[model samples]
Target: MQTPFKLSLSAQDIACERGGRTLFRNLDFAVEPGQALLVSGPNGAGKTSLLRQLAGLLPLAGGRLVTDGADADTPIAELSHYVGHLNAAKTAFTVRENLAFWADFLAEGQGDPADHLAGALAAFGLGELGRLPAGLLSAGQKRKLALSRLFAAPRPLWLLDEPSVSLDVASVKKLDGAMRDHLKAGGIAVVSTHVPLETKFTHTLDLGLERAA
Candidate 1:
């Protein structure tokens, strides 16, 4: 059997700010392998900011973030995949090309790119659209292409901001299934979303409550 991936991520007394405004403070949460962290809050509650801090894209206003297991000394960006609200894809590239580029760029010595490429496309219902340019895809399809990167290169931590946005019901189910499989394989996911996602193990952190305190 393949050895399971181990991951431990925690935030303590964390704080974030944006646009000269304090979004949240003293936020804390721990995510373990085989589990998910669901971040929920009202608009401008710092949900996305918190995820960015964890992903190392934004500097924390206060407190420290800790990570254990699997290249602990490596920067969070190297060990995690951060998918923000925007679909980060090359509009000029075809679906296959986009996935292929990510698979190569983020290999991390994991599974074969060919396998990941095929699996990601199939997982997100994009197998038939692989040759189509990303810019031509519908909104939902663009979202799927963005999400396929998670599978294209297996990362231990996933920081997703509003991952379910623009997804159809069927696509949402697919996303849930992918998360379930990732957790089952000992991967960790931190998702900020208004849409409820069904997973086997989940922990929720409400940023609105953190902001109110």
Candidate 2:
């Protein structure tokens, strides 16, 4: 909480293992505010594993992770939003209801205009379908719904995994803008993408070459 280093990520000899196989080890890196870390690698390179570790989902094999700056003093309960492949789409509720549920669950305040699902719906090309049941949406549409949840979140850290998957070209561009705005808003994003990014990376961390086992 002392702002030891702005936007800090310090992992000393960090390692991870899955299914008895060591995924990666002795990995150490740090990124600061106004910087984005692009995580890329071939499939099965432990990209997701590293992101999960940063999000505090998976335990680090040998080291620790510390995020400061805007996230200083923020509890893991409040520091970040971890979004992956899970479909939070409600088979029974409309898209609006799904986001509403998220806002309440994340303890976000009500009557917040920025939490508008409509704007996100339009940005993602799902405007007309906000009233429709999420279960009725196509796979791609479902992914868009997942993205809309971010707007209603107050966390400063974003852990996104392969967010570009299943998105069309235009949707990917819109997604890019959303991510950029998040960074511009002083948020930190750690994303793992197999697909290309729309903008230059502040830094690229390759997990494939860093595997320790």
Candidate 3:
């Protein structure tokens, strides 16, 4: 897959606050095109919060988040794809229908999502399950379905929070391979995981340490 888009992510002394408590502060990191940044921390260390901030779903309590190589007017949310803990599939929808919805929404104007639908299902071994209702899929299958969107549409930045939650070892490997392919294509990934992944990560940010400081 040829990735014609180019973008880099950087955070400068960022901070996050929830309710009345500070989750993390003075956090900083940079990930260039084709690089992956691994975020690991103890529970409640704000790993998800940090990822949310990068995804533009949560506001930073302090500091700057920058994306280089994209149009200055482009919103970071538009240039990035965010997958959190929830498997956002609509249970009432069929496997392909669920994926197609996301592909169309995320890849809006990029291309006919149908062009990539079959390939996305095959990437995660969901080809045979495409016609089944998502509610009938196993937990792991649901996760795979959620992840299929990463391939259904190509985005410059990927913000994944605990993406391997329900994945079996083989599925994890598939995810790693997909991530590597994305990196090789000049895309960036910020992954927050407690389970060590097989993918190559160029940088790591430990919010646990920041909270301890």
Candidate 4:
């Protein structure tokens, strides 16, 4: 997949807060095109809050979030794909339906959404389970289904929070491959996870250390 335009994500002296408490302050990071940023921290260090801020789901407590090389009028959220802690699949819908819905809503490229459905499923080794109901899938399978959205629609920025949560070893490898392919295509990824991923990271931020200092 190719990005519609060149882009890079950067933050200067960013901070996060929840419940009137500051999590981290004076944090800085940059992710250029074709690079990944790995966020690590102990519990309550605000990894999820940081990702949410990047995704535009939460307001930044301080500092600026900047994207270079994109249109000034374009919102960062429109250029990003955020897969948070929860798998946003609708249980009653079939796996295919869930993916198809996301493909239609988040469509960016040419052709029909249906045309990308099968390929998305195949990308995550969920080819045969498309017909199954989403609720019937195991934890790992659901995670893959949620991840298939990356292939279903092409986006330059990916904000993934604990994406490896329920994935098995092989599934995690698949996830790594998908991320690698995205990076190879000049996409950027910001991921938060406790487990080590096979994906090669260009930069890493340890929120725990940031808070300690």
| Top-TM-score candidate index | 3
Candidate 4 ranges with C-alpha deviation above 4 Å: 1-5, 108-111
Local distance difference test values of all predictions, in order:
0.86, 0.72, 0.88, 0.88
TM-score for candidate 1: 0.95
- Cα misplacement distance, residue 168 of candidate 2 (Å): 0.9
> Which residue ranges in model 2 land beyond 4 Å of their true spot?
1-7, 70-73, 109-125
Alpha carbon lDDT at 87, candidate 4: 88
Model 3 TM: 0.97
User: Against the true structure, candidate 2 has what lDDT?
Assistant: 0.72
Q: lDDT (0-100) at residue 168 of candidate 4?
A: 88
Which regions in candidate 3 have their CA more than 4 angstroms from the true location? Answer: none
What order do candidates take by lDDT, descending?
A: 3, 4, 1, 2
| Clash counts for the predictions, in order | 0, 0, 0, 0
Q: List clashing residue pairs in candidate 3.
A: none
Query: Higher lDDT: candidate 1 or 2?
Result: 1
Worst 10 residues of 3 by lDDT: 1-10
Instruction: Identify the runs in model 1 with alpha carbons over 4 angstroms from their true place.
Output: 1-3
As for candidate 2, its clashing pairs are: none
